[model samples]
Target: MSETLTPERVRADVAELLGCEPAEITPGENLFDRGLDSMRVMILVERWRAAGAASLEFPDLAECPELGHWTALLTGDGA
Candidate 1:
């Protein structure tokens, strides 16, 4: 949200919530496998929506659960 809805910002936001560095969040990695739960995903959905990603939804993320996919979805670069 600090910088526009970019992929990097998405990574940083997810990283912050996961309690790790942005670099640790590989784009193709499964966030759920990295400890991201539905509650946290919902938290991110609300946060990203507030930051202008109004179309983002929990099901959109839950169906994929990958950082790259989420980044793209939030940044308008993917489905």
Candidate 2:
């Protein structure tokens, strides 16, 4: 079975995976420009896929490419 996708969990994972503080990930923060590299993005993608379909990936994660995007993904809203 797959783990559930929860907003709090997602935010925590994103923070850990990107080496950022939770507060650094506001709703409109930009991962790339803010310091998220392609390599890190790839790692995040892989982790997401391994986590099952409930995980978010690159393209889908690229919509806003900001904190808001990540916030939306974790909250079950966004594309």
Candidate 3:
């Protein structure tokens, strides 16, 4: 079964990339501003795609760079 993408999951992924606590990743905060790079973003894309988010892409997450937005996009609740 496909894993569901939740805000907490998104936060956890971002936290792993940033090397910080999940709570440090606020929903509306910009990930890039918090030190996220292309490499880490691609890592997240690959991980999520493997988890069944087949439609996810670098630009989709790069353009938004926010936890809530990433969660919505991954969960198919956003355009």
lDDT of 2 by residue, 1-79 (tens): 6665556656666788778777667766677777777777777667666666444667877666675666566556542
Which prediction has more favorable lDDT, 1 or 2? 1
How much is the lDDT of residue 60 in candidate 2? Answer: 76
Give me the candidate number with maximum lDDT: 1
List candidate 2 segments past 4 Å from native: 54-57, 74-79
lDDT of 3 by residue, 1-79 (tens): 8676766677788899899999877778888999999999999999899888888889999998988789888775432
lDDT (C-alpha) at residue 3 in model 3:
72
Q: Candidates sorted by lDDT, descending order?
A: 1, 3, 2
- What lDDT, from 0 to 1, does candidate 1 have? 0.86
Candidate 1 per-residue C-alpha lDDT over 1-79 given as tens digits, one digit per residue, 9 for 90 to 100: 3448888788888999999999988778889999999999899998888888787888999999998888777776642
Model 3 Cα shift for residue 29 (angstroms)? 0.8
- The C-alpha RMSD in Å for every predicted model, in order, reads 2.5, 3.0, 2.4
Which is the better candidate, 1 or 3, if ranked by TM-score? 1
